[model samples]
Every structure is written in structure tokens, then in C-alpha cells.
Target: MQTALLFPGQGSQYIGMGQDLFTRSIVARRTFEEASEILGYSVSNLCFQGSEADLTRTDYAQPCILTVGIAAFRVLVERMEREPVYLAGHSLGEITALTASGALHFADAVRLVRFRGMLMRDAQKHKAGSMMAVHGLTPQVIEKECLEPEYRGLVVISNLNSSRQTVVSGQVNALTKIKERFTDLGGHVTPLQVDGAFHSPFMKNAAMQLYDELRLIPFHSMRYSVLSNVTALPYPNVNCIPSFLSEQMVERVRWQGCVQFLMERQVYNLIEVGPGSVLSNMLRREKLDACMIQSMDKKEYLQKLIKESLPKGNRAVSYAHYLKAALCAKNYNIHGETSNYLKEVAGPFRELEQLARSGDVADGNAKALEALNHILDCKMTPAIQRGGILSHIAEEGVVRHV
Candidate 1:
């Protein structure tokens, strides 16, 4: 099966991420250095060793997250040398994925993300807006809740995560009302740690500024498929990418539909090449068949997934799976030998009911494994460090045992 590479966006960043690779991998380290020089700031220092507050700022978070994601990506490609048939990114990550596909230069991509963050952050300077997750409720229900009488004109849908889960954004009071309605409907609701009502009309001003910056930047044709947020379809050219980048802020993040489009195109394997497995989690929920999904944000998970994806002839996949089975041998509770997970990834929890039925998929583990090799390159890991801090914190807080 052909492979697909995915990149995550804004919501994934936290302090002290990409810390291990920054120190361990020379290629990963160079990505940080290049980013720092291009941005005219010590972003690598901030990404590897800055404080939470410092890393969390929009200006800092934008380039910082992108750097780590790209660093992990470079390590993956350099190591695996696997070519993907298509590329996709969520929100801000779209630009990163496009660049990885040879659509844009790395430096131009960084500049765009920097300005993109600045514009989005400035848009809500005076607005006390927020986003809340609505679980077990359809997008229709939550969208209706926002426009009810007192809360009308305040709330709007921001992230269409899946059929069963969505993130709505609006004025504080409107969001509160929506959350209350969700609770009463026996749905789960949680608040997101975001600064503004992103991906909504509230970001119209941000779109304007980004449009100006996008016009100044140059874009090149993509080497592979690039699914866009505005179209919820594959972007065929680079000429229109700049405008789409800005317009996306004022548009809805049709993530669920995006996943559907991927599946329809037979993209069985998916890799999230940035901090956190948030996007992978969403894809897992939406996949009908149990498919291969991996993240390159950390070292452990991606390594495990890539090891799982190799062709039967490729000894690396066999060896890795052998190791996992051998190490976790005590937990299987079976006496006879297994096929080294030859069929599919065995796990519980598909998702919640119909939403899960349509959202979470079931498939063979082969595609999933292959995708890992496409963008992760062997050095990147999926395992998250237990006590690792964000880059800002790692810089100042990590102390030697001595």
C-alpha cells in the first residue's frame, strides 16, 4: 500500500517538546539552528529550553512547534528514505506538510507560520473568546446551542473533529451556554487552553493580515497531494495556497470530512509528524478498519509503528514486532504463538457508538507501519518522556542527577 504523511497544527504544542531529538540527533539539531537564524531569534533555545509561558505565546508557539515537527520529519525522511504518495496537515500544519512534499521552501514556510501566528493572535486582542469540546453531541446540536437568544451572534463552530466530537468557539458567555446545554444532553464538554476563537469569523481580521504576508511570499508546485482546510479536498496547485492559508482562519476546520476524503482515496496508513498524537488520535477514531497510525513527535511510538509497517521481506519490521511480542510476552495470556500481530493492531475502544462506528476504523497494521517509515525515518520515537518539560522549561529546569 502507498503511504501518507500528516502534520499537526497549533493545538498540539506544549513547553519542552522535541527535547530529546534536539540533543540526540544532529539533523534534528540543525533544523532548530536554521529556524533560529531565519526567524532572527533564539527559537531553538526557546524550543529546547524555554519556560511554559514563553513557549505558549502565539509568536513563540508557532515557529517553535513547526521547528520541532520539521526536525522530527527531516530525521524520519533521512533515515527511512520512504516516499509518500500524498501529504496533509491540519490547520497550521498544512503549510509544513506542503513544504515536506516539496511545495515550498523551509524558510518561507517558517516565515509564513510566524506571521500567521502573529495575525491570529492579534485578531482577538480585544475579544474574550474561547473554545469548548462537545462530546456525544452532533455538530448540529452544538451549533444550534450557540445561537439561542442571549448567546446568539456570539458562538460558532470552530473544529469539526469528527462526527461525534467537535470544538465550538465564541464569546465567553455563549460558550458557557453551549457547555451547559451539552451537559444537560448527556454529552461531555471540556474547555480548551486556547487564547482566542480561532477558525471562526472572530479571526476575520487575522485573515486580512495573513493575506498581506502571503502575497509577499513565493510558493512552488507541490510534489504530492496536499489536502486543504478550506476545500476539505486535495489542493492541486501551489498558486492558490497562500490565499487559502489566510482564508482558513475565518473558515471551519472540517477535519472529519478531511479524514473521510483520505479514506475514500484508500490512504490506509497515517503518520502525525509533530508534537503529541492528537491528530493521529482523531484519525484512529475515524478509521473504519483498524489502520496503521503513528506520531513522530516523540521517539518511542513512531519507532514502534514504523517497525510494525515494514514489508514481510523487510527484516526490520519483523525484528521490531518480534521484540515487542517478546518483551510484552508475559501480558498476552496465551500459550501458543501469535502471528506477531500479522493481522491488525489488537486493542479495545473503537469509540462512542455510531460516532465511533463512522469515525474510528478497523484495518490491517501493514499500512500503518509503512506510513511511519515514510515520514518518521528510524531515529524519531513515539514514546513520550515521562518527566520531560516543554522546550522553555527544559532549558532552565532540567538538572543533572549530580
Candidate 2:
């Protein structure tokens, strides 16, 4: 199956999330433990015992939600032997997606988001803005209304969640003034419980601060493609990671576009891996009949996915084997700095090749992709040459299976 994994952002978090997974799975427990050590707070206690108000605080919510999402993903990775073709996240969930894709270490991601949440919370204190969800209105109508003289430069669409659901963020007064206008236009305006006007110009200062933090952190090449909420497309490359992620804070989350991109790429299975069913519900609203949507939140859902293992002789597995052989036969010649090539490219490829031979289709596919990413990151190879190799691998190793 051509599968895509989705991660939920803030507002999807709730107390007691991931408790069952923590109790039932060692991998889940360890993930939470690792995050806690890095964060210097018990994420497990926060999720399983903290009050709703505490969990709702932006400073506390971001890391907590990210930890739970990563815990769930680790549990799934341990139990299921399937590699998703793409990964996407909503708002704060984007960091979770990057972490899962191997672009960021879990420790670095958790610390970065915690700092992000603090900056956003401080921004809210300074500017005092809010957000509201507008339902039953087309984005065009909402955009036009936001452009009205009374609200222009104050209110803007923050999240394009779906065709019928959009979230607006701005100064409190601007949202208040527009709510009545939207109500009169047959749109239901529900105030969101967020602290600040996220994904709007209100977050400009915070985004800049986040950019500095992002620069200090190291980003790795991703094993799987991660869709950027700011662009609603796969991230272009690691060089653009910090800037794109910083821009995501003040730019509208093009979730609807991200979904469209996935569907256009023939993703038939969509799994929401996080604390709540928010993303899954949004996907359902899209009415994609050809897509099979599943959410991994509770223990039962995890069990169900584990039980649905792929049958033997699947095309994905066969393709992975072919990829392994092709990789083995490929030349590793480079123009200069052979040491960097050996360290960054050849060494990782050797390890991934061994993983591909381990008889687990999921591991094999994931390793093959990681190996490809390593090769692409080799600066010794020309960009055009690397692109050609990637194209060849995709055509031979992936296209036929789809």
C-alpha cells in the first residue's frame, strides 16, 4: 500500500493520551523516558496525570504533544513492518514529522519545540491575539472578508484545514469584529482555545526568534519525504529546513493542499499517528473514498494495525530486494574529499544495506530510503549526477510497485 503518516498539532493534545501505549509497549515507554530526560520534565506524568489547563498551556503543550506523537510512532515502528511513503504534520506536528523522518534527532526536536512554545507564549503576552475556526465557508469567501477595510492587515487565514473548515488568526479586536460578519454570511465562527494568533503576522517576531534557534540545531537528511505546512509540498532539501520551518509559524498551514498533494501522488492509505483523531476527522471531511484512513491513538487501534501485516511476496518487499542489489552494484566514485564520502555516504549505505538484508520488509524499505538520502547528501557528488541516480532508483525501485 502507498501509505502516508500524519501527525496532529496543538489542540489535539489531551490528558491521559499515550498512557495505554506507555504501559503496554516498551518502545513507547522508552521514547517518553528519553524525551523526559532531554526536556528535564516527566512527559509521561504530564500526559497521564497533569490537568487539562496545564496541558493546554502553549509552553507545556508543544513538547508534551510531540513526545506523545513520537511515542506512538515508535510503538508503531516496533510492531508494524511497513514503511510509509510520505509524512505530514499540522502546525507543531511538523516538527514531529521531521523527527520521525530522521531529519532531526528526537532530543533536538523536543528542546526546540519547547523553546518555540515559550517564544510563542511570550509573543501572545506582548501582543494579545487569538484565533477562531470558521466552518461552512469557502476559503475564497473568507479571504475576501478578511480583506475588508475593517479587518485588512489585522486578520488572516491561519490554517486551511479543509474545503469547508478554515481557521483565522489576528488581534483579538479584529477577530471580534469579523465574527459577526462571518455569522451573517452563514459561517459558524467558533473561538479556538489557543493562546496566540498562530500562523499569522502576529507571530512575525516569534518566527524570527525561532529562526535563530533553528540555525543552532543540526538537521539530517530525511529517510522519507516530509510535507511542509508552509508550502504543502515535500521539503526541497535540508538547506531550506530552518527557513521553511521558521516561516511556518507566520504562514498559513496549507493542510488542504498537503492532502491534495498526497492524493495526487496516489497515497491510498493515510494513518494519523498522534494523541487525537483531529487529523483523521479532517481527512474524513475530504470524502476520499479510495483512501483508507486509520488513527493510532488508543491501544486497540495499535493492535489492529499490528494484526494487519502485509502478506508474503508483496511487491514492496520484492522491490526492496531489487533496490538492495542495485545499490550494491552502483559505483561510489567521487571527485574529491574521499573521507567525507566514506563517512557520510559509503558507511551509512553499508549499514543500511545490512538492514535491508535482515528479512523484514519494513526495515529493508526504510533502510533503502535512508541509504539513498545519504548518497544524496554527499557533497563530493555533483547535484545533477545525484539527481540522476535518485531518479533512476525511484523509477526502478518504486514506480512499478505503485
Top candidate by TM-score: 2
Query: For model 2, what is the alpha-carbon lDDT of residue 5?
Result: 90
lDDT of 1 by residue, 1-402 (tens): 556788888778776688776765555666788798999988767876788777666777888888888877765663343456677788878888877765566788888888887776777778878777788988877777777787776888888878768888888877877677789988998887667788899988789888888888755445567888888888867778767888888888887878878778788778788888888887767656746787886578655533442223211122233222222322221321244232212321111122233432212222222322222211122212111211112233221110
* Global lDDT scores for all candidate models: 0.66, 0.78
Candidate 1 ranges beyond 4 A from true positions: 302-402
Off by over 4 Å in 2: 306-402
The global Cα lDDT (0 to 1) of model 2 is 0.78
Per-candidate clashes, comma-separated: 37, 0
Clashing pairs in 2: none
